[model samples]
Target: MKRSFSILSLLTQGTGLLALALALGGNPPARADENLFGFVRGAETLPKGHYDVYQTVTLRTGKDVGVYRGWDSDTEVEYGFTDKLQGSLSLVNRYIYNRGVEELDDTNHLTFGGFEGTTKYRILSPFKDPFGLAVRLETGWLLHDEVAGLLEHEIYVAPEIIVQKNFLDDTLITELNFGGEWAWGKDPAEQYYKEFSLQGGVGVTYRIAPKWFVGLEGHARGEWPLFNFNLFEHSVVYAGPAIHYATERWWVTLSYNYQIYGHGIDELPRTQTFAEETRHEIRFKVGFNF
Candidate 1:
């Protein structure tokens, strides 16, 4: 177990360095308003009366042979309570149709919901330079019923920082985002089934036009046994390109994600047979605000 934990720590650090290197190697394009933290969009480009709504369909494919799935939708709604302060809520609903599973415990997959709230403050505007910078912090909690039992919840604490710059009449801009999450209660590492995880990610966004944008993001998640097998750990790497579109009060995004899982976690000293697992998934996201 101790050996497993050590390997995961080293791998996570190595992947983080790689992400930094990639970000630096990119072309030196014109700077724009960018947020260096958080996946949730704050004021972005909205006024007081405007709100936004988003929905996404995600397709997940397992590593094993003959494993396929359907579209899983995630929905979110946000409203500008005030200019700098906003309130938002998100929920996920999906259908899982797996082939060849003999009477799996969770059926059809109905009845699931979670809630989160974010407050953003606009620190500064683009001024005459057509560039802006902002700092924001938000707190949220998650509740999952199917995992353990009803009323059993998972806790997530996230603090983020974001920076945005606008260039060439806002037609072209760049964004930088970075943040970390500390999770507890319930299994934070889905594959391990029981463990606490600390994870962080960095992302950059480039706007091609008024309604079109592209992004490159890299994230790392590491988990260690909190209760049993305290020395065991696991790490994962995810990076991909994403697209965004907006129509009045509605927004949508689509992307392909590639994921790599490190070794050590699957090779338990007690368990003789080692299980190797690694794969990719296609993610679709749609959102709206009022």
Candidate 2:
């Protein structure tokens, strides 16, 4: 199914941001649920009964073709059931505009993409414990392929292990994440297939100023046609820099990633993966705590 959002969503986002601007003078945040990196996740969960609203935008372009551009807008709400457990729900809207792409036909459209549910459990606290550790599970159903922009019926589950460490009296922070993703879906042609992928990332962040952070992150991912790696099809690597700012009521993070290396099914991708990946990606996120 292809879904589309009306003007109400744009109005909602605008109003929410306007509210955030008005509350800039509110007391600083007492919680650590804010995001420090764009692609990497930290091992921090919200305190019990705490709620946070987030808006994330992702841009994927540079497909080595003629003017290919895609954007995803995600709106998410997160709630903490306990100090160690947190859950979130999100909706994704997708827009694509392309012309004269070698692989893709000319198209311009904006549609509702999908929704997802995510749960996280913290086992160690980076602030109190020697190091932080957490487990996160994400389940989602989508109607469109993430990179290809093709219609499909796909349900996926991704489980990840997250670790965090703090140094320099909390001025410097590091996080590592590794995960496996499994999906069973019908492609655009209505053919069923099972896909699996292994992905990992590492990130380092340092406080540059009050409530401002600068970070670097790296990511690697490889996919298989089935559950085993013997059928591996492609892999990609990305490295990037990120900037983040947080306050008592709101936080925003922005990042840019460049495809570093990859391998495709038929050929080795020297600098990037063009078959199923993009050469450049940009992400921006803003969060409000309630």
Candidate 3:
């Protein structure tokens, strides 16, 4: 059944492409979302034929104790395929080392890549005026896991609706983007589970100069596990300020989100402790269009 659903995901993704190709038929370009550092939403204006690149390194402080050291890194590359279509690929690597252990009992590392595709449909053009509505559909596929043979792979299908309004001569723009995601995965224990995710946020951007702008944003995602991983359910939220620079074919963003707190765990049933840790991390990304 899990394999069947995976096949369905590919089939539905193809169907979405067909719908986009037919619906786009020379339609006007749609506006893009605006969370700079975290998962929040912003009222960002994007022109056709534009590209962006994002790169960032995050350091986790005090994650290590006298027994363990932890580090993680993620690299994502995304492109605007059209005025309303975007695609991305990401590589993530994580490491955990025993602080004072050796002899094949001290270190672990895992690396994986994810593929994603997204499409946006503008119900109304915000550029012509100030108020508009839009919808976005996206999906992702996680590659095979090397460390956890019991962990197969997972997929997510989500749809989001966004509303934007510009006030005070476009200097102050406010936006609300909210949506839900469905996730499914296979466990090495020959079990399958699914979950639902709720994502939403609000943000505003200010034009500091002709080509520069600064903005503040916040977003959160909550999930409830309903099968193999029922013990893994939590919510994560983040917020911060981001600076955006725009050019014809290239755009760059440098933003940071402070610890708003959330939660997740790779292993089930902690053997040493029973306290829930609030999820916190910083992410930096760059995007380009060609």
* Root-mean-square deviation per candidate: 19.6, 14.3, 16.6
**lDDT tens digits, residues 1-290, model 3?**
99999999999999999889879774544334433334454334344555444444443322213343334455655555655454545565555444442222444555453555566656665556558677777787755432221245678799998788877777666778999888777343223366677889877778888757788877777766663335555566667876777654445666555546655555334322111222234445445544
lDDT per residue as tens, model 1, 1-290: 99999999999999998889878984443222222222323225334555666565666555344343544455766565555455556675545544443223333444353555555555655443345555555454555533222233556666555556656665554555455555555543243333445555555566777767787765555556553436656566666777777654455666665675444454544311112223455766655444
Clashing pairs in 2: 3-112, 28-248, 29-248
Q: Please give the lDDT score at residue 75 for candidate 3.
A: 63
Which TM-score value belongs to model 2? 0.87
**Ranked candidates (TM-score, high to low):** 2, 3, 1
- After superposition, the stretches of candidate 1 with alpha carbons farther than 4 Å from their true spots are 1-46, 64-72, 99-108, 125-152, 187-196, 204-210, 225-232, 260-264, 267-278
Counted clashes in each candidate structure: 35, 3, 11
| Ranking 1 against 2 by lDDT, winner | 2
Better of 2 and 3 by lDDT: 2
- C-alpha lDDT score of every prediction, in listed order: 0.52, 0.87, 0.56
Instruction: Select the stronger candidate by TM-score from 1 and 2.
Output: 2
Q: Which stretches of candidate 2 lie over 4 Å from their true place?
A: 1-29, 189-192
lDDT for model 3 comes to: 0.56
